[model samples]
Target: MAEKDQVAARARAVTERFQFGPWSMMTVKSHILKSEGPTRERFESQLELPQVPEMIFADNVLRVIHDDGYGIEFNALDALKCVDAHHDPLKVAVSQAWREARSSCEHINDVVKPFDWTFTTDYKGTLLEKEDKKITVSETTERIDIEKLKVREKILFYEDMLLFEDELADNGTSLLNVRMRVMPSGFFILLRFFMRVDNVMIRVNDTRLHYQAGKNYMLREFSTKDDQVKEIKASQHLFTDPNEIANHLTLRKEVFEKLQFPETPPEEGS
Candidate 1:
Protein backbone atom coordinates (compact mmCIF):
# COMPACT_ATOMS: atom_id res chain seq x y z
CA MET A 1 0.00 0.00 0.00
CA ALA A 2 2.80 2.40 0.84
CA GLU A 3 4.56 1.82 -2.47
CA LYS A 4 1.33 2.28 -4.42
CA ASP A 5 0.60 5.51 -2.60
CA GLN A 6 4.06 6.77 -3.49
CA VAL A 7 3.53 5.98 -7.16
CA ALA A 8 0.17 7.74 -7.27
CA ALA A 9 1.69 10.76 -5.56
CA ARG A 10 4.43 10.94 -8.15
CA ALA A 11 1.88 10.84 -10.96
CA ARG A 12 -0.17 13.59 -9.41
CA ALA A 13 2.85 15.89 -9.42
CA VAL A 14 2.78 16.07 -13.24
CA THR A 15 -0.96 16.03 -13.84
CA GLU A 16 -3.26 19.00 -14.46
CA ARG A 17 -7.05 19.22 -14.47
CA PHE A 18 -9.77 21.69 -15.38
CA GLN A 19 -13.53 21.83 -15.61
CA PHE A 20 -15.55 22.71 -18.68
CA GLY A 21 -19.31 22.72 -18.53
CA PRO A 22 -20.28 19.38 -16.91
CA TRP A 23 -17.03 17.69 -17.86
CA SER A 24 -13.73 17.47 -16.03
CA MET A 25 -10.65 17.09 -18.21
CA MET A 26 -7.19 16.03 -17.05
CA THR A 27 -3.78 15.68 -18.69
CA VAL A 28 -0.65 13.98 -17.39
CA LYS A 29 2.94 14.34 -18.61
CA SER A 30 5.81 12.30 -17.23
CA HIS A 31 9.57 12.30 -17.93
CA ILE A 32 10.26 8.63 -17.35
CA LEU A 33 11.31 6.91 -20.61
CA LYS A 34 12.58 3.49 -21.67
CA SER A 35 13.85 1.91 -18.45
CA GLU A 36 13.75 -1.42 -16.68
CA GLY A 37 10.75 -0.83 -14.40
CA PRO A 38 7.36 -2.32 -13.65
CA THR A 39 5.69 0.09 -16.04
CA ARG A 40 7.95 -0.98 -18.93
CA GLU A 41 7.59 -4.66 -18.06
CA ARG A 42 3.80 -4.45 -17.95
CA PHE A 43 3.73 -2.58 -21.26
CA GLU A 44 5.83 -5.25 -22.96
CA SER A 45 3.84 -8.15 -21.53
CA GLN A 46 0.47 -6.63 -22.41
CA LEU A 47 1.50 -5.42 -25.87
CA GLU A 48 3.36 -8.72 -26.51
CA LEU A 49 5.73 -6.92 -28.87
CA PRO A 50 9.33 -7.92 -29.46
CA GLN A 51 10.19 -4.54 -27.94
CA VAL A 52 8.32 -1.46 -26.86
CA PRO A 53 8.73 1.96 -28.44
CA GLU A 54 11.81 4.08 -27.89
CA MET A 55 9.82 6.47 -25.73
CA ILE A 56 6.78 5.24 -23.85
CA PHE A 57 5.18 7.57 -21.34
CA ALA A 58 3.38 4.84 -19.45
CA ASP A 59 2.05 7.29 -16.86
CA ASN A 60 0.85 9.85 -19.38
CA VAL A 61 -2.89 10.06 -20.00
CA LEU A 62 -5.64 12.42 -21.16
CA ARG A 63 -8.97 11.81 -19.45
CA VAL A 64 -12.41 13.42 -19.53
CA ILE A 65 -15.08 12.79 -16.91
CA HIS A 66 -18.70 13.82 -16.96
CA ASP A 67 -20.45 15.07 -13.87
CA ASP A 68 -22.94 12.20 -14.14
CA GLY A 69 -20.05 9.68 -13.72
CA TYR A 70 -19.37 8.74 -17.36
CA GLY A 71 -15.77 8.92 -18.51
CA ILE A 72 -13.45 8.43 -21.51
CA GLU A 73 -9.68 8.51 -21.68
CA PHE A 74 -6.66 8.24 -23.99
CA ASN A 75 -3.52 6.53 -22.75
CA ALA A 76 -0.35 4.99 -24.10
CA LEU A 77 -1.18 1.46 -23.01
CA ASP A 78 -4.62 1.35 -24.60
CA ALA A 79 -3.44 3.05 -27.78
CA LEU A 80 -0.58 0.60 -28.21
CA LYS A 81 -2.98 -2.26 -27.73
CA CYS A 82 -4.63 -1.35 -31.03
CA VAL A 83 -1.39 -1.79 -32.93
CA ASP A 84 -1.20 -4.81 -35.23
CA ALA A 85 0.58 -7.62 -33.40
CA HIS A 86 0.87 -9.84 -36.49
CA HIS A 87 2.94 -9.17 -39.57
CA ASP A 88 1.44 -6.51 -41.79
CA PRO A 89 2.05 -6.80 -45.55
CA LEU A 90 2.45 -3.04 -45.88
CA LYS A 91 5.50 -3.09 -43.59
CA VAL A 92 7.06 -6.35 -44.75
CA ALA A 93 9.98 -4.71 -46.51
CA VAL A 94 11.13 -2.81 -43.44
CA SER A 95 10.54 -5.81 -41.23
CA GLN A 96 12.63 -7.97 -43.52
CA ALA A 97 15.46 -5.45 -43.51
CA TRP A 98 15.36 -5.27 -39.75
CA ARG A 99 15.56 -9.04 -39.45
CA GLU A 100 18.46 -9.30 -41.88
CA ALA A 101 20.48 -6.68 -39.95
CA ARG A 102 19.83 -8.36 -36.61
CA SER A 103 20.53 -11.86 -37.97
CA SER A 104 24.26 -11.38 -37.52
CA CYS A 105 23.94 -10.04 -33.97
CA GLU A 106 25.09 -11.82 -30.82
CA HIS A 107 21.56 -12.72 -29.67
CA ILE A 108 21.06 -15.21 -32.51
CA ASN A 109 18.92 -17.50 -30.36
CA ASP A 110 16.42 -14.73 -29.57
CA VAL A 111 13.38 -15.06 -31.82
CA VAL A 112 12.12 -11.85 -33.35
CA LYS A 113 8.38 -11.90 -33.85
CA PRO A 114 6.99 -10.30 -37.00
CA PHE A 115 4.84 -7.29 -36.17
CA ASP A 116 4.13 -3.78 -37.37
CA TRP A 117 7.38 -2.02 -36.56
CA THR A 118 5.83 1.40 -37.16
CA PHE A 119 3.43 0.93 -34.25
CA THR A 120 0.46 2.38 -36.09
CA THR A 121 -2.68 2.24 -33.96
CA ASP A 122 -6.29 3.06 -34.77
CA TYR A 123 -7.33 3.61 -31.15
CA LYS A 124 -9.98 6.25 -30.64
CA GLY A 125 -10.24 6.18 -26.84
CA THR A 126 -11.18 3.97 -23.92
CA LEU A 127 -14.48 4.32 -22.11
CA LEU A 128 -14.72 4.19 -18.32
CA GLU A 129 -17.61 2.46 -16.60
CA LYS A 130 -19.51 4.10 -13.79
CA GLU A 131 -21.59 2.00 -11.36
CA ASP A 132 -24.89 2.01 -13.27
CA LYS A 133 -24.72 5.06 -15.53
CA LYS A 134 -24.08 3.51 -18.90
CA ILE A 135 -22.83 5.38 -21.96
CA THR A 136 -24.12 3.79 -25.15
CA VAL A 137 -22.49 4.32 -28.54
CA SER A 138 -23.78 3.79 -32.07
CA GLU A 139 -23.04 4.77 -35.62
CA THR A 140 -24.09 8.36 -36.20
CA THR A 141 -24.94 10.34 -39.31
CA GLU A 142 -24.14 13.61 -37.52
CA ARG A 143 -20.65 14.92 -37.95
CA ILE A 144 -18.63 17.47 -36.05
CA ASP A 145 -19.14 21.01 -37.33
CA ILE A 146 -15.67 22.02 -38.36
CA GLU A 147 -16.91 25.43 -39.50
CA LYS A 148 -18.23 26.19 -36.04
CA LEU A 149 -14.90 25.33 -34.49
CA LYS A 150 -13.25 27.78 -36.88
CA VAL A 151 -15.31 30.66 -35.54
CA ARG A 152 -13.58 32.83 -32.98
CA GLU A 153 -14.52 32.11 -29.38
CA LYS A 154 -13.07 32.64 -25.96
CA ILE A 155 -10.66 29.79 -25.23
CA LEU A 156 -11.27 28.50 -21.73
CA PHE A 157 -8.52 25.89 -21.54
CA TYR A 158 -6.16 23.96 -23.79
CA GLU A 159 -3.56 21.17 -23.54
CA ASP A 160 -1.47 18.91 -25.77
CA MET A 161 0.30 15.82 -24.53
CA LEU A 162 2.46 13.13 -26.12
CA LEU A 163 1.43 9.54 -25.34
CA PHE A 164 4.32 7.60 -26.89
CA GLU A 165 6.91 7.81 -29.67
CA ASP A 166 9.61 5.78 -31.41
CA GLU A 167 12.43 6.32 -33.90
CA LEU A 168 11.47 3.20 -35.87
CA ALA A 169 15.00 1.88 -35.62
CA ASP A 170 16.23 5.04 -37.33
CA ASN A 171 14.29 4.17 -40.48
CA GLY A 172 11.75 6.85 -39.66
CA THR A 173 9.49 7.90 -36.79
CA SER A 174 6.27 6.84 -35.08
CA LEU A 175 4.36 9.00 -32.62
CA LEU A 176 0.98 9.44 -30.94
CA ASN A 177 -0.34 12.51 -29.19
CA VAL A 178 -3.58 14.18 -28.12
CA ARG A 179 -4.64 17.81 -27.96
CA MET A 180 -7.83 19.33 -26.55
CA ARG A 181 -9.27 22.83 -26.45
CA VAL A 182 -12.21 24.17 -24.50
CA MET A 183 -14.28 27.06 -25.77
CA PRO A 184 -17.34 28.77 -24.42
CA SER A 185 -19.46 26.69 -26.78
CA GLY A 186 -17.91 23.28 -26.09
CA PHE A 187 -14.75 21.14 -26.20
CA PHE A 188 -12.85 19.45 -29.00
CA ILE A 189 -10.11 16.84 -28.93
CA LEU A 190 -7.79 15.29 -31.49
CA LEU A 191 -5.85 12.10 -30.86
CA ARG A 192 -3.40 11.40 -33.66
CA PHE A 193 -0.92 8.64 -34.48
CA PHE A 194 1.48 9.39 -37.30
CA MET A 195 4.21 7.29 -38.85
CA ARG A 196 6.82 7.83 -41.55
CA VAL A 197 8.80 4.93 -42.99
CA ASP A 198 11.51 6.31 -45.24
CA ASN A 199 11.11 5.37 -48.92
CA VAL A 200 8.17 3.14 -47.97
CA MET A 201 5.06 4.91 -46.80
CA ILE A 202 3.43 7.48 -44.52
CA ARG A 203 0.41 6.77 -42.32
CA VAL A 204 -1.82 8.86 -40.08
CA ASN A 205 -4.63 7.81 -37.78
CA ASP A 206 -6.79 10.54 -36.27
CA THR A 207 -9.53 10.45 -33.67
CA ARG A 208 -11.60 13.57 -33.18
CA LEU A 209 -14.12 14.20 -30.41
CA HIS A 210 -16.56 17.08 -30.12
CA TYR A 211 -18.90 17.84 -27.26
CA GLN A 212 -21.32 20.74 -27.50
CA ALA A 213 -22.20 22.47 -24.27
CA GLY A 214 -25.52 21.33 -22.86
CA LYS A 215 -25.84 18.57 -25.44
CA ASN A 216 -26.99 15.07 -24.42
CA TYR A 217 -24.26 13.31 -26.36
CA MET A 218 -20.73 13.56 -27.73
CA LEU A 219 -19.54 13.10 -31.34
CA ARG A 220 -16.50 10.96 -32.12
CA GLU A 221 -14.75 10.30 -35.44
CA PHE A 222 -11.84 8.09 -36.42
CA SER A 223 -9.98 8.41 -39.71
CA THR A 224 -6.98 6.78 -41.36
CA LYS A 225 -4.83 8.09 -44.22
CA ASP A 226 -1.79 6.66 -45.91
CA ASP A 227 0.23 6.73 -49.13
CA GLN A 228 3.41 5.37 -50.60
CA VAL A 229 6.40 7.60 -49.94
CA LYS A 230 7.18 7.97 -53.63
CA GLU A 231 3.66 9.18 -54.38
CA ILE A 232 3.84 12.20 -52.12
CA LYS A 233 5.14 15.28 -53.92
CA ALA A 234 6.28 17.64 -51.20
CA SER A 235 9.33 19.05 -49.55
CA GLN A 236 11.24 16.50 -47.51
CA HIS A 237 11.10 18.84 -44.52
CA LEU A 238 7.30 18.64 -44.41
CA PHE A 239 7.45 14.83 -44.08
CA THR A 240 9.29 15.24 -40.81
CA ASP A 241 6.37 17.04 -39.20
CA PRO A 242 3.41 14.90 -38.18
CA ASN A 243 1.03 17.83 -38.36
CA GLU A 244 1.95 18.40 -41.98
CA ILE A 245 2.35 14.80 -43.03
CA ALA A 246 -1.37 14.05 -42.79
CA ASN A 247 -2.15 16.57 -45.49
CA HIS A 248 -0.15 14.60 -48.02
CA LEU A 249 -1.65 11.19 -47.35
CA THR A 250 -4.90 9.86 -48.82
CA LEU A 251 -7.86 9.18 -46.57
CA ARG A 252 -8.42 5.43 -46.37
CA LYS A 253 -11.16 4.92 -43.80
CA GLU A 254 -13.47 6.87 -41.46
CA VAL A 255 -15.94 6.00 -38.70
CA PHE A 256 -18.28 8.31 -36.80
CA GLU A 257 -20.07 7.44 -33.57
CA LYS A 258 -22.25 9.08 -30.98
CA LEU A 259 -21.89 8.37 -27.28
CA GLN A 260 -25.25 8.87 -25.61
CA PHE A 261 -25.35 9.59 -21.89
CA PRO A 262 -28.01 8.13 -19.68
CA GLU A 263 -31.03 10.41 -19.53
CA THR A 264 -32.55 9.32 -16.24
CA PRO A 265 -31.01 9.81 -12.83
CA PRO A 266 -30.14 6.85 -10.62
CA GLU A 267 -32.61 5.63 -7.98
CA GLU A 268 -31.92 6.73 -4.46
CA GLY A 269 -30.16 4.07 -2.31
CA SER A 270 -31.58 1.10 -4.22
Candidate 2:
Protein backbone atom coordinates (compact mmCIF):
# COMPACT_ATOMS: atom_id res chain seq x y z
CA MET A 1 0.00 0.00 0.00
CA ALA A 2 2.78 2.40 0.83
CA GLU A 3 4.50 1.87 -2.48
CA LYS A 4 1.26 2.33 -4.38
CA ASP A 5 0.51 5.56 -2.55
CA GLN A 6 3.95 6.90 -3.27
CA VAL A 7 3.57 6.11 -6.94
CA ALA A 8 0.23 7.86 -7.07
CA ALA A 9 1.64 10.90 -5.31
CA ARG A 10 4.51 11.16 -7.77
CA ALA A 11 2.14 10.87 -10.70
CA ARG A 12 -0.02 13.65 -9.40
CA ALA A 13 2.95 15.93 -8.84
CA VAL A 14 4.25 15.61 -12.39
CA THR A 15 1.17 15.68 -14.57
CA GLU A 16 -1.06 18.47 -15.86
CA ARG A 17 -3.94 18.39 -18.32
CA PHE A 18 -5.94 20.91 -20.30
CA GLN A 19 -8.58 20.99 -22.98
CA PHE A 20 -8.35 23.28 -26.00
CA GLY A 21 -11.17 23.19 -28.49
CA PRO A 22 -11.40 19.58 -29.66
CA TRP A 23 -8.00 18.61 -28.27
CA SER A 24 -6.77 17.56 -24.86
CA MET A 25 -3.14 18.01 -23.90
CA MET A 26 -1.11 16.61 -21.06
CA THR A 27 2.45 17.19 -19.90
CA VAL A 28 4.62 15.32 -17.45
CA LYS A 29 7.92 16.37 -15.82
CA SER A 30 9.44 14.09 -13.25
CA HIS A 31 12.28 14.52 -10.77
CA ILE A 32 15.90 14.92 -11.99
CA LEU A 33 16.41 11.17 -12.66
CA LYS A 34 16.68 7.87 -10.86
CA SER A 35 19.89 6.36 -12.19
CA GLU A 36 19.36 2.88 -10.77
CA GLY A 37 16.65 0.27 -10.38
CA PRO A 38 14.04 -1.10 -12.74
CA THR A 39 13.40 2.06 -14.76
CA ARG A 40 17.04 2.64 -15.59
CA GLU A 41 17.67 -1.00 -16.36
CA ARG A 42 14.67 -1.21 -18.65
CA PHE A 43 15.68 1.96 -20.46
CA GLU A 44 19.19 0.67 -21.05
CA SER A 45 18.04 -2.72 -22.20
CA GLN A 46 15.51 -1.36 -24.69
CA LEU A 47 17.79 1.39 -25.96
CA GLU A 48 20.59 -1.03 -26.74
CA LEU A 49 22.90 1.95 -27.00
CA PRO A 50 26.46 2.13 -25.72
CA GLN A 51 25.91 4.99 -23.27
CA VAL A 52 22.99 6.76 -21.68
CA PRO A 53 22.80 10.49 -21.27
CA GLU A 54 24.21 12.16 -18.15
CA MET A 55 20.75 13.47 -17.26
CA ILE A 56 17.63 11.64 -18.37
CA PHE A 57 14.09 12.47 -17.39
CA ALA A 58 12.76 9.04 -18.16
CA ASP A 59 9.25 9.89 -16.99
CA ASN A 60 8.82 13.04 -18.99
CA VAL A 61 6.09 12.93 -21.65
CA LEU A 62 3.94 15.21 -23.77
CA ARG A 63 0.65 13.87 -25.16
CA VAL A 64 -2.26 15.32 -27.09
CA ILE A 65 -5.59 13.71 -27.82
CA HIS A 66 -8.33 14.75 -30.17
CA ASP A 67 -12.06 14.26 -29.75
CA ASP A 68 -12.06 11.90 -32.69
CA GLY A 69 -9.85 9.43 -30.78
CA TYR A 70 -6.67 10.33 -32.61
CA GLY A 71 -3.63 11.26 -30.59
CA ILE A 72 0.12 11.86 -30.61
CA GLU A 73 2.63 11.59 -27.83
CA PHE A 74 6.26 12.47 -27.12
CA ASN A 75 8.25 10.55 -24.55
CA ALA A 76 11.90 9.90 -23.78
CA LEU A 77 11.67 6.20 -24.52
CA ASP A 78 10.26 6.65 -28.00
CA ALA A 79 12.62 9.50 -28.76
CA LEU A 80 15.70 7.56 -27.73
CA LYS A 81 14.58 4.60 -29.81
CA CYS A 82 14.98 6.76 -32.89
CA VAL A 83 18.66 7.43 -32.19
CA ASP A 84 21.24 5.63 -34.33
CA ALA A 85 22.65 2.87 -32.18
CA HIS A 86 24.77 1.29 -34.92
CA HIS A 87 26.67 4.27 -36.31
CA ASP A 88 28.13 7.67 -35.51
CA PRO A 89 28.45 9.37 -38.86
CA LEU A 90 29.09 12.74 -37.28
CA LYS A 91 32.15 11.58 -35.35
CA VAL A 92 35.17 13.86 -35.47
CA ALA A 93 38.48 14.47 -33.67
CA VAL A 94 36.79 16.09 -30.71
CA SER A 95 34.34 13.19 -30.44
CA GLN A 96 37.26 10.72 -30.28
CA ALA A 97 38.93 12.72 -27.53
CA TRP A 98 35.69 12.81 -25.59
CA ARG A 99 35.20 9.07 -25.98
CA GLU A 100 38.75 8.38 -24.81
CA ALA A 101 38.25 10.54 -21.76
CA ARG A 102 34.96 8.81 -20.93
CA SER A 103 36.56 5.35 -21.32
CA SER A 104 39.14 6.22 -18.70
CA CYS A 105 36.44 6.98 -16.11
CA GLU A 106 35.53 4.33 -13.54
CA HIS A 107 32.88 1.79 -14.70
CA ILE A 108 32.50 3.67 -18.02
CA ASN A 109 34.59 1.44 -20.24
CA ASP A 110 32.77 -1.71 -19.17
CA VAL A 111 29.40 -0.54 -20.52
CA VAL A 112 30.61 1.46 -23.50
CA LYS A 113 29.01 0.26 -26.73
CA PRO A 114 29.77 1.33 -30.28
CA PHE A 115 27.08 3.91 -31.03
CA ASP A 116 26.60 7.61 -31.65
CA TRP A 117 27.73 9.26 -28.44
CA THR A 118 26.06 12.49 -29.48
CA PHE A 119 22.54 11.00 -29.00
CA THR A 120 21.00 12.72 -32.00
CA THR A 121 17.44 11.67 -32.91
CA ASP A 122 15.03 12.58 -35.69
CA TYR A 123 11.97 11.51 -33.71
CA LYS A 124 8.84 13.41 -34.65
CA GLY A 125 6.55 11.78 -32.06
CA THR A 126 4.38 8.67 -31.93
CA LEU A 127 0.92 8.72 -33.40
CA LEU A 128 -2.02 6.94 -31.84
CA GLU A 129 -5.38 5.89 -33.26
CA LYS A 130 -8.51 4.32 -31.87
CA GLU A 131 -9.37 0.95 -33.39
CA ASP A 132 -12.76 2.27 -34.40
CA LYS A 133 -11.57 5.63 -35.71
CA LYS A 134 -8.42 5.75 -37.75
CA ILE A 135 -6.70 8.85 -39.11
CA THR A 136 -4.63 9.17 -42.24
CA VAL A 137 -1.32 10.95 -42.55
CA SER A 138 -0.06 11.84 -46.00
CA GLU A 139 2.55 13.98 -47.66
CA THR A 140 1.20 17.44 -48.32
CA THR A 141 2.40 20.56 -50.08
CA GLU A 142 0.40 22.72 -47.69
CA ARG A 143 2.70 24.55 -45.34
CA ILE A 144 2.12 25.69 -41.77
CA ASP A 145 1.31 29.37 -41.65
CA ILE A 146 4.09 30.97 -39.68
CA GLU A 147 2.49 34.39 -39.98
CA LYS A 148 -0.73 33.15 -38.44
CA LEU A 149 1.06 31.83 -35.39
CA LYS A 150 2.50 35.29 -34.75
CA VAL A 151 -0.89 36.93 -34.44
CA ARG A 152 -1.80 38.21 -30.99
CA GLU A 153 -4.07 35.86 -29.06
CA LYS A 154 -4.91 34.85 -25.56
CA ILE A 155 -2.49 32.23 -24.31
CA LEU A 156 -4.41 29.44 -22.63
CA PHE A 157 -1.84 26.86 -21.54
CA TYR A 158 1.88 26.24 -21.92
CA GLU A 159 4.52 23.79 -20.75
CA ASP A 160 8.02 22.59 -21.49
CA MET A 161 9.54 19.20 -20.72
CA LEU A 162 13.07 17.91 -21.06
CA LEU A 163 13.39 14.29 -22.13
CA PHE A 164 17.12 13.70 -21.70
CA GLU A 165 20.48 15.41 -21.78
CA ASP A 166 24.18 14.64 -21.70
CA GLU A 167 27.26 16.82 -21.36
CA LEU A 168 29.34 14.61 -23.66
CA ALA A 169 31.92 14.01 -20.93
CA ASP A 170 32.37 17.77 -20.58
CA ASN A 171 33.12 18.16 -24.28
CA GLY A 172 29.71 19.62 -25.20
CA THR A 173 25.98 19.15 -24.70
CA SER A 174 23.22 16.99 -26.24
CA LEU A 175 19.59 17.19 -25.25
CA LEU A 176 15.99 16.63 -26.35
CA ASN A 177 13.02 18.70 -25.22
CA VAL A 178 9.43 19.46 -26.13
CA ARG A 179 7.32 22.59 -25.65
CA MET A 180 3.64 23.26 -26.26
CA ARG A 181 1.35 26.28 -26.21
CA VAL A 182 -2.40 26.63 -26.46
CA MET A 183 -4.29 29.69 -27.62
CA PRO A 184 -7.89 30.57 -28.31
CA SER A 185 -7.16 30.15 -32.00
CA GLY A 186 -5.31 26.85 -31.85
CA PHE A 187 -2.35 24.98 -30.37
CA PHE A 188 1.26 24.35 -31.41
CA ILE A 189 3.99 21.96 -30.37
CA LEU A 190 7.74 21.79 -30.90
CA LEU A 191 9.94 18.77 -30.22
CA ARG A 192 13.64 19.49 -30.62
CA PHE A 193 16.81 17.46 -30.25
CA PHE A 194 19.95 19.55 -30.23
CA MET A 195 23.62 18.54 -30.03
CA ARG A 196 26.85 20.46 -29.74
CA VAL A 197 30.17 18.62 -30.02
CA ASP A 198 32.69 21.24 -28.94
CA ASN A 199 35.06 22.35 -31.71
CA VAL A 200 33.43 19.83 -34.01
CA MET A 201 29.79 20.36 -35.01
CA ILE A 202 26.30 21.40 -33.97
CA ARG A 203 23.03 19.81 -35.06
CA VAL A 204 19.38 20.55 -34.47
CA ASN A 205 16.43 18.32 -35.37
CA ASP A 206 13.04 19.93 -34.99
CA THR A 207 9.45 18.69 -35.35
CA ARG A 208 6.63 21.18 -35.28
CA LEU A 209 2.88 20.47 -35.08
CA HIS A 210 0.16 23.00 -35.62
CA TYR A 211 -3.59 22.56 -35.33
CA GLN A 212 -6.31 25.14 -35.77
CA ALA A 213 -9.60 25.36 -33.92
CA GLY A 214 -12.43 23.33 -35.52
CA LYS A 215 -10.04 21.94 -38.09
CA ASN A 216 -10.23 18.33 -39.21
CA TYR A 217 -6.52 18.13 -39.84
CA MET A 218 -3.20 19.13 -38.35
CA LEU A 219 0.15 20.00 -39.93
CA ARG A 220 3.46 18.48 -38.95
CA GLU A 221 6.86 19.63 -40.16
CA PHE A 222 10.24 18.04 -39.51
CA SER A 223 13.45 19.87 -40.27
CA THR A 224 17.15 19.37 -39.59
CA LYS A 225 19.89 21.99 -39.35
CA ASP A 226 23.58 21.24 -38.98
CA ASP A 227 27.02 22.65 -39.60
CA GLN A 228 30.65 22.35 -38.60
CA VAL A 229 31.62 24.63 -35.73
CA LYS A 230 34.15 26.49 -37.85
CA GLU A 231 31.65 27.10 -40.63
CA ILE A 232 29.22 28.99 -38.43
CA LYS A 233 30.07 32.66 -37.79
CA ALA A 234 27.73 33.22 -34.85
CA SER A 235 28.96 34.47 -31.49
CA GLN A 236 30.02 31.81 -28.99
CA HIS A 237 27.37 32.88 -26.49
CA LEU A 238 24.61 31.69 -28.82
CA PHE A 239 25.71 28.10 -28.28
CA THR A 240 24.39 28.13 -24.73
CA ASP A 241 20.75 28.27 -25.83
CA PRO A 242 19.45 25.68 -28.30
CA ASN A 243 16.89 28.09 -29.74
CA GLU A 244 19.52 30.72 -30.24
CA ILE A 245 22.06 28.38 -31.79
CA ALA A 246 19.42 26.91 -34.10
CA ASN A 247 19.11 30.24 -35.89
CA HIS A 248 22.75 30.09 -36.91
CA LEU A 249 22.83 26.58 -38.38
CA THR A 250 21.93 25.81 -41.97
CA LEU A 251 18.85 23.74 -42.80
CA ARG A 252 19.74 20.40 -44.34
CA LYS A 253 16.41 18.61 -44.61
CA GLU A 254 12.66 19.20 -44.34
CA VAL A 255 9.47 17.14 -44.59
CA PHE A 256 5.84 18.09 -44.27
CA GLU A 257 2.81 15.88 -43.60
CA LYS A 258 -0.82 16.35 -42.72
CA LEU A 259 -2.77 14.27 -40.24
CA GLN A 260 -6.39 14.02 -41.26
CA PHE A 261 -8.90 13.30 -38.55
CA PRO A 262 -12.32 11.78 -38.86
CA GLU A 263 -15.34 13.84 -37.94
CA THR A 264 -16.20 13.24 -34.33
CA PRO A 265 -19.68 13.24 -32.88
CA PRO A 266 -20.72 15.97 -30.48
CA GLU A 267 -20.58 15.31 -26.77
CA GLU A 268 -23.84 14.26 -25.14
CA GLY A 269 -23.97 17.37 -22.98
CA SER A 270 -23.52 19.63 -25.98
Which digits, one per residue and each the tens of the lDDT, describe model 1 over residues 1-270?
Answer: 259855874865587899887889998888755577565676688876666687888878889998888879999999988887776545354555444534443332253676666788999999986898777788888899999999999889998989899876666788999999999999999999988877677889999999999888889999999877778888888988878878888899999888887875322331
What's the CA error at residue 237 for candidate 1, in Å?
2.0
lDDT of 2 by residue, 78-104 (tens): 888888888766645346545555554
Best by lDDT: 2
Each prediction's RMSD over C-alphas, in Å, is: 5.0, 5.1
Task: Report how far off residue 52 is in candidate 2 (Å).
Answer: 1.4
Alpha-carbon TM-score of each model against the true structure: 0.87, 0.87
Model 1 segments more than 4 A misplaced: 1-12, 92-111, 264-270
Local error of candidate 2 at residue 115 (angstroms) = 0.6
